[model samples]
Target chain A: MSEALSHRDRCAIAGIGATEFSKDSGRSELTLAAQACRAALQDAGLTVADVDGVVSCDYDLVSYGAIADALGIADLTYWGQTGPGGSGPCAMVGQAVAAILSGQATTVLVYRALNGRSGRRYGLGAPDPDARVGGRGAYEEFFAPYGLVTPGQFFALLAQRHMSTYGTRYEALAEIALACREAANRNPAAQMHERALTLEQCLAARPISLPLRLFDFCLETDGACAVVVTSAERAADCAQPPVLVRAVAQSTGPRVQPGVMYPMLMRPDITVTPSQTVARTLFSRAGLGPSEVDVAQIYDCFTITVLLQLEDYGFCAKGEGGAFTESGALRPGGALPINTAGGNLSEGYVHGMNHVLEGVRQIRGTSTSQVTGAEVSLVTSAPPPGTSALLLVRG
Target chain B: MSGMFNDVAVLPLMPVEDDHDTGGFFAAARRGELALRFCSECGQLLHLPRQVCFACGGARSEWRAVPGRGRVHAWTTVTHQVHPAFPTPYTVVLVDLEEIDARLVGSLPGEAELEVGQPVRVRFDRAPDGTTVPNWEVEA
Candidate 1:
């Protein structure tokens, strides 16, 4: 193992901000990106001038230069973007940390903004078949021709394999949807806040794809979320108590990364995700174990993602994810309260950026479904086509 | 095989066109055969056929035929409509080609009840435009 001269606790998430979670924001992605960045800077007690760096998801419709131009920042010393959308939330922060630690820039703005519902729904199946740009058409031809077009369908293939291999039942999947929806009920900002979900409801919900019902899928939302990252010293002076970035790691399982989102089928075992590789590096660098994580914001792009991640992240033994979730460990005040602010399934999917904002809240003790004394917060990105994770602790 | 796909009849049968790397896979499908690319240098089978061998970095590869028999590794009955070309209620299956050590995805012609490990075989579906795609059927 390499020396643990890690950059743990060297920087912290100083502030987080977001627009109202909704189905239609009626704003351009650039506007949403700019607004969220402004709100985040204000929350950090900093201004556009204080932001020497910017980091965002490459999938974000708004570019860093566009955000910089919109925010009227005179100059930016560093700017970066990470990929494949949902897998980028934690990695975006990791990029900001790299920029900060390497003295490339300081006071970075990490943001993800999208009008997912109104502009272009990600779940809306295959793209234009005529446009072959970016090689998407080529990769998609294999699956799209078979009607395996959407992320839900792609993931369902894996979920089906997991169920067959481990005897994982649909009830476990329901438990995940229920836990996240129940958390969303307490979060007023969540799109599903006013709606409550029951086990019967989730079970009765129509199947979008077999093994994954309607409720098993995440909400198509329009919103933006941003957080300010700075060195530990600068974070202490911010408006909110610093949620130290203890560790950050991103990885792709060997040979599992192909076709970006559709490569899950290529794995030797579909049930295992890239989270297993990321978990080792994340905890080793944090100098903490999964047991020490007081709360978690596991990426909930799909209910199965959480179930598989539960096993892959070492929270429970492999093949025991179904039982672990059914044990009520993911509920508020349970062994590990997850998605306290609703997560993608309920809160809103600004991709997984909202999950990061919620992690900061859990550590700040401001979550609506707060884990009483959550000092260690775990946030993970999507599991396939590469994955990323972050370990945050109270400063 | 034209009437064989009656159960899966949709407005547009093909949602995507084949590109350079996938041209061979589609061509093989049109010829009513299952051919996959094999790396000449490293002897690796490339499914979802790539131009080069990711395993050996070998650019030399040729199309090779194998028995189009496999087991249903996973499947899903897609009810929600995402594209207008594809109507509701079609079963998509992922096949585990054990012999070739490769995997392929295709849609079952009907709402066939399926389970993991069920033996299946591939069949070719030719469109009116002479486009042929490989689909799966459960082996008796």
Candidate 2:
């Protein structure tokens, strides 16, 4: 138990890779998964055969066995899936580190593949009603039928509560969209690269749900992203300088609510996210405060999400989120540069794996929108805040 | 928004999602009363009915009638059409039920000045299929 608390920096992510960010990749998810995994392994100076362990985000439509077949990987010592979104690449890295430390596996590969735009519209609708019918909960069965279908509508409740409690303005959320779009304009890979966002355009953008406008939602992108993790010793010899995992922590609120949206009835404060609980353990394990984080790749499912995360991650005080994000602090050359790769808003939603890749890039000082002298990058995942935060340090 | 529920011309796609957990809710709505789930062993009020008590892990459950008065805990007006049954610019609300100690998600009829913590009352409205759904009522 004590060893578990002190195991930070034991494993390092040696490589990161992703397919082109796009609205339509015109390829099966299996193909995208194989391509990304191959790219990551090659980047790490390791072959598929060297990988004895595999992990996947729960949201990934492709299964581990299918990906292994596509990668031509023969044997596996450790294999598992962390989340459909409850835990993402960061948590997967945590699992990989645990396996390596226990001698259950040496090299572990974590990947997330989704054809969100072409195959399944992530922003459009509810889960399969058949699944809901066979079995579902309040949000699905009771709440969903009342027109609470899409994630935007679900998160709208959070955004509304946040605004009411803190007197937050729409302009606060607009700052995030503007900052991310500006960063995306600098990066050629961003899906919304040329499409810069202005505060006027953002405010005037058609409302999807009140308190959440069109600019609030993330792009419906098609792609896959992957990362390679190995022993810290092994990563020291890899082609790219190792990005050590200083700390990786995944946590849920007091209630063990499963699925995309946990019933918020159990929680006292409607404005708080899982990131609040997650950030404490993450910073504790890393022995570093939020102020030490040079760059951040916070999950930007919605602009309001960025505001909530900034507060939950302790960048500001509770209810000070609206004021905290008003400055250009999240942009390039700002106080705490965030989402340098444009994030899910302007970049692509590789289901938070892209955020992890950006975190690794920031640590390595190779990001196109690089923050100068970034030694540590804090990356966070999406909500119920089925959130995980990882601190990556330059090796 | 006020009472679009009064629009006899509109037909709802699926008024309620019927499952083991929420079958009682629709049944209660049919009888013109708001009912909620409670774990007797745990003495806890539960929403989105669970087969087992999540807190105490006890399977025994029962339903109790609630007064159906609540405050708008959080709400949003969805301008986008998610389902044809629910038209554009509809307001969806999560209500914190008053003495009952539970929360319910319901819709307000038409565009109205709504805010969090505003007092509201629940009223039974007919889904096109005639299944009763609890809708929120407020003086716009």
Candidate 3:
């Protein structure tokens, strides 16, 4: 827990890029990866020859070498990937920072490209036993046979507990859904940009699982989003304003094993997620606190994911998320405007990569729903088997 | 099971026969009993059976049968069907097996009014795949 030798502000994100978000990209994952990588390099005033490192999520269909090859990057010095999906975006940036500070590579490309809606959708439920490889490990035997398949179903049990424990209401969830949709309405890049959601519409949405409705789930979208990372010194010479990486941390609570994908059954208390640990480590390393965060891009894979993280990340006291969100804290003019790019909820589900892009945008003063004078932005990965978070400050 | 909902037959994905970790649990279920793996060295009970003891790093574990009754910790009624095999509208419950210090998830195939902390007992049902798996019935 030595915080004195922190890597805060050692690296910066100098470029950001993405392709059109839609239900079907109509392109191969590799093409999407190459398109986003080229755009990111061009954004940073760099080129394929400038990039020596590559990083992505393990669930990404395209391999790191394939991306570098597609973009004409030769002689890569470093490449890596983080796993289990959802909890990857911020960690990917963290990987880039570690690589840069350690001299494994000079310039790194962090990207995520997938046609999630049209290909291998996560919410479609469990894969056939024969179809699954090594990661799950006796997982389906315990839950799938009983009809507990999708991530949404597991979160429903958690949300139900939180509701029973804290009196959290569905209307509070509606508040979160409405806020993101309102933000999306202002951002043309958002899939839900043209569509505005009302409290009434959110509240009345049909149930996918109890205590969680259709709107509660994030959009299953097809898209690719990426960012370019380099040494803070090098970033200053790039094209766009550098968003300094203040701190990043990833953690998993004790006893969160065995049920790798969804460990709800083993957890003593399902209300708290791994974000609690990540928050403590992230802020401690950054030499800052939650009160200093001007805006956030908390992952919204599900509305409950947002609610639990609100408490776990210390945005509010435990069990106070419902009332806190109801107070409009997550809205545009509220205390902390989150998911300003509409997030995974409305913008697109490029996993949480879009959240990272939005965080960088807020720092660069380029966000469509930009928070006025926002200097410090927080971006968190999904709250699950494990979680990660990052702090970006205006450089 | 008189009031159970059976209109939609569910043929859920069954366990792989050679899965070393979960094979014993399924074998016990076929015999109309609920069993879980316990660390032979440290006595830590584990569900979704594990190869080693997480509590003490014990390398050996063994299967033990326990009472099938427990209280519902939390639950959800899934209205949307994510798989073709499982039709819409099924209630899944997480039961806290306080007696064995373990937890398990099973579906309520019949109509039952369920709530947190309500008593539930496990019942064995044969899947369409010809494998016996544990489901739940609310105890009146």
For model 1, how does the per-residue alpha-carbon lDDT over B1-140 read when each residue is reduced to its tens digit?
Answer: 12133223332436344565667776777677788888889988777677789989989988887788889888888888887666788898989875877888888754669988889887777767666777778888
DockQ result, candidate 2: 0.46
Question: How well is each residue in B1-140 modelled by candidate 3, as lDDT tens digits?
Answer: 11122222434566554577777887777666778889999888766587687889987999888888889988888888787756778788888875767788878753346878899887777655556777677886
Q: TM-score of every model?
A: 0.95, 0.93, 0.95
TM-score of chain B of each: 0.83, 0.81, 0.83
| lDDT tens readout by residue for model 2, A157-274 | 8888988888999899999988888888988888988886789998898988887999998988889899999999999988999999999898886764544663653356778888
How big is the positional error of residue B60 in model 1, measured in Å on the Cα after superposition?
1.3
Best-fitting candidate, scored by DockQ:
3
Question: Runs in model 3 with CA error above 4 Å?
Answer: A1-5, A129-138, B1-11, B110-112, B127-130
Query: Per-residue lDDT tens digits of candidate 3, residues A72-188?
Result: 887899999986668898999989999998889999999999999888888987567444222347366677767777899988888998998899999988888888898899999
**Candidate 1 C-alpha RMSD relative to the actual structure:** 2.5
In the predicted model 2, the residue pairs found to clash are A58-A83, A58-A84, A59-A84, B1-B110, B1-B111, B1-B112, B2-B109, B2-B110
TM-score of 2: 0.93
lDDT of each: 0.86, 0.81, 0.85
The TM-score of candidate 3 is 0.95
iRMSD per model? 3.2, 3.5, 2.8
